[model samples]
Structures are given as structure tokens and as C-alpha cells.
Target chain A: MPQTHTFEMGMTCGSCANAARRVLEKMGEGITIDSIDVPTKRIVVTTEKSAEEVKTQLEKTGKAVSGVRITHIESH
Target chain B: LHQGKVSVEGMTCMSCVNHIQDTIGAKEGILNCTVSLQEKTATVIFDGSLWNGESVAEAIDDMGFESKLIS
Candidate 1:
């Protein structure tokens, strides 16, 4: 089952957001980025990967990650 | 210790610079890291036995930026 993970990131500019997007994109397949809003410092993604795994990857971007929440889930 | 220059792109603010410095500086064998947003480069002093220009550049590239070994 694919889960949507919402992450709190400390991004200061568009480039930071872009970097975050790229980091998540490189985490192999089965991951879709819903949004990476710099102003709100939020990143939303739907992926089959675990939240811990995704968080670990995001941290590699050298950004502070405040938290993660499972926003949505699909039942099928 | 050895010094290497890496050209990094996609950094727009001081936060980016500081993040690069803080992250890489804390890594093992990295003596220091100075990132210049204006110049779009990062100069790293690291243990030559543990790191090289290619590895340092690869580290920056892994951070979601376009990086190349300058020297």
C-alpha cells in the first residue's frame, strides 16, 4: 500500500525546495512528490517507502527536518 | 590535510551555504568546509587518505546540487 508522507522541512529558498525535490526523486521509483512549498516549509509525497527511509534521504540535503506525518492512505 | 575546490550550483541563500558547511564539516575526516554562494563553490580541507576532489564533489552532488571537482 502506498502512503502519503508529509514532512516539515526548513527550506529558505526556491533552490532549497528544488534540492529537496531532487533528493526525494533520487530515492528510486514508486515515489511521487505532491509539493514542496518553501514558504510553508512543507513537503508532501506519496510513496511506498517508509517514513523513516524518506526522512533519512531528506536529511541528506543538509536541511533541518522538524517532523513527519502520514497525511493520507489508500485502501484497495 | 588536503584542500579541494568543488563547484556547486543551485544554492540561493546563506542557509544553503551554512548547511553545506555544517553538514560536510561535521563529517569524518573533513577538517573544514567553506561554501561561497556568490562564487558557487565549496572549498574543503579534508584528510587526503579519506577524501579526494571527486569524493568531495560527489558528496555535494548527493546533496541535490550540481557539483564538479574544480581542482
Candidate 2:
């Protein structure tokens, strides 16, 4: 199943959005970032990876990462 | 080694990101700073021996914005 998870990344400014995008882009297969709200520092990512793994990769950017919510799931 | 992440609020455009990048980039102990208008978040890498969160937040506040650490 493909699922979208939201994470509140404690980002400071716009460049942080770029960095977060880069981290998502750099992650291994099975996941794709759908969209992100720069103003809110919230991101929605879709992935085949577990929620924990997704959060871990998102936090890898050195941003404060937390589970916001997960939805829009589809089975493969 | 110390790392910090902060949430920047009241930024409505890309210029806001540039403003923050420049401000944090100039801090004494900061080795790197990245800002995201898309997410309103900034991750900072600094020499902890030289600076801390309050000062960093102050720097952001001085820029005419609001900042708060997440962790």
C-alpha cells in the first residue's frame, strides 16, 4: 500500500524547505514526497516504507521531526 | 557537536527565506543554515561552544520575525 504521512518539521525558513526537499529526493526507493507547506513547516510524503522509516528519513535532514498524521493510503 | 531546528513564522514569501538565510548565515558560531519558505523551518549547524538557541532565536527575532525551537 502507498500511504501519505504528514510530519511537522521544525524548520526555520525557506532554505529549510529546500533542504527538506533534498532529503526526500535523496531517500531510497519506495517513497515520494507529495507536497510541503513552507509556512507551516508541514510536509506530506507518500511511501511504501513504514511510517517510522519515513519519519526517520525526514528527520535525517537535521530538522525536528514529528508525526503529524497519515492518510490517503492505497494498496499496491 | 550541537544541532538545532527552529520554526519561523510570519514569512509570506521567498524573500523572507533569503532574509533568514542571510541573518543566520552571519551568526558567529553558525557553520550552516538552511531556510524553507515552503515549510517555514530552519535547521542550523553551529559551534555550540560559541552560541546557543536563545541567541539564535534572538537573531531571528531581530530580523522582524518569530522563531521557536522545536526541540
Candidate 3:
């Protein structure tokens, strides 16, 4: 089952968003980015991976990831 | 030490420039990293034995931006 997680990140522009998207894409699978909103500094992704795992990957973009919120979870 | 110049793409603003500077600057062998958003370029000073222009460009590329060694 996949879980939808929303993360608060330090993204200022589209390039920052793109960086985040790329990092997640490089995760190789089981992760789908729903949206990256710079204004809200939020990134929403649905993935089978754990939040900690996803958070670690996001940190590679060199942006600060303040926290993660589990917005939706599929019923197993 | 060696100086390298790299052309970078996909940077939209100052934050992108700062991100590049901070990220690359913290890497081993990178003595200095200066990014110019207007010029779409980054000039790096690194240990010659550990890093070169091509490697710096590759590092930038790995950060999800399009980059190439200019000199």
C-alpha cells in the first residue's frame, strides 16, 4: 500500500521545485510526486517507501526539509 | 589548487545560486564555489588532484541541473 506524504521544504522557485522533483525521480520507483508548491514550500508525494526514507532523499537536494505530514494512507 | 569554470542551466534565482554555492562548497576538495545566475555559470576552485572542471560540472549535473565544463 502507498502512502501520501506532504513535506514542508525550503523551496523558493520553480528550479527548486525541479530539483526536488528530480531527486525524487531518481529514487528509482515506487514514488510518485503529486505536486511541488513553492509558495507553500510543500511537496506532496505518494509512495510505498517510508517517510524517513523519502525525507532522506529529499534532503539531498540541499534544501531544508522541516517536516513531513502523512495526508493519506491506503488501507491494507 | 585548480580553478574550473562550468556552465549551468535551470537556475531561476538567487536561491538557486546560493544552493549551488552552499552545496558544492561543502564538498571535499572544493575550496570555493561562486555561482552567477545571470551568467548561468559557476566558477570553482578545487584541489587539482581531487577535482577538475569536468568533475565539478558532473557534480552540478548530479544535482539535477544541466551543466557542462566550459574551461
Candidate 4:
């Protein structure tokens, strides 16, 4: 199953967005970045892992993460 | 070899420290990169002929963080 997770992160610029991408990329395979909106301070990611697990990984990037929510879940 | 310091703003945690260090240290001619979250600064050592403070500052800036060469 694939799950989509949305997180509220403090991102101010393109560089911040890129940094977030880089951090997620470092999380290795099985995770894909759906989008990062700096103005909205929202990051959407799709992965096989649980939202809680993904949130833990994202927090390692040193950004202030306000919240994480499971937006969608796919059985396939 | 050249050693310099740059002040960085908007770092929230040690992960930011590691990200900055790894990002800058990954560049060619960069010998070492140390980032201090508490000080909001980064110190780098690099080959002067192949790199400079401007390039390092630019790299940091490109990462969405504000950086200024202090030395």
C-alpha cells in the first residue's frame, strides 16, 4: 500500500524547499516527494511507510515541523 | 588551503547543522565543513586555488539558508 502524508514545515525560500527535498532524498528509496510549497509551508510526500515514521525522518532535517497528517491511503 | 567562517541564519536544529556541513563539504576542493547551530555559523576549509568564500556562500544560499562570509 502507498500512503500520502502532508506535513507543515517552516520553509521560507526555494533553498529551504530544496533542502527539504535533499533531506527526503537522503531517506533512501520507497519514498517520493509529491510537492513542496514554501508559501504554504506544506510538504506532501508519498511512501510505503507510515506517516508517523516519515514524520520522524523529516524532523531530522532540522526544520520546525508543526504537524503531520495522513492525507490518503492506497491499498494497492 | 584556505579557512574561513560564514554566519548562517534560520537554522533550527542539529539536522540543519549536518545538512549545511554535508552540502558544503560535498563540493570539490572543500576539505572540511563544520556547522554550529548554536552559533548559526559555518566554518570551512578548502583549496584556495579551486574554491573561495563566494562559491561556498553561494552554495549555502542555494540551500535556502542565508549565509554571509565572515572571514
Instruction: Name the top DockQ candidate.
Output: 1
**Considering only chain A, what is the TM-score of each predicted structure?**
0.92, 0.83, 0.91, 0.86
What local lDDT score does residue B16 receive in model 4, on the 0 to 100 scale?
66
Please give, for residues A24-47, the per-residue lDDT of candidate 1 as tens digits: 888879999999998999999998
TM-score of 4: 0.53
Candidate 3 residue lDDT tens string, B28-61: 9999999999999999999999998999998887
Model 3 clashing residue pairs (backbone): none
How many Å off is the CA of A14 in candidate 2?
A: 1.6
> Which is the better candidate, 2 or 3, if ranked by TM-score?
3
lDDT tens digits by residue: candidate 3, A40-74: 99999999899999898888877889778897764
Task: Report every candidate's CA lDDT.
Answer: 0.91, 0.73, 0.90, 0.79
lDDT of 4 by residue, A1-76 (tens): 7778899987766657777786688678999999999899999999998877776656655567867878666455
Give the docking tier of candidate 3.
medium
- For candidate 4, the lDDT comes to 0.79
- What lDDT tens digits, residue by residue, belong to model 1 across residues B1-71? 89999999999889888888998899999999999998999999999999999999999988988899999
- Evaluate residue A11 in candidate 4 and report its C-alpha lDDT on the 0 to 100 scale: 71
Spell out the clash pairs found in candidate 4: A15-B63, A15-B64, A16-B64
Ranking according to lDDT, highest score first: 1, 3, 4, 2
Candidate 4 chain A vs. true chain A: TM-score? 0.86
List where candidate 2 sits over 4 angstroms from the true fold.
A72-76, B1-71
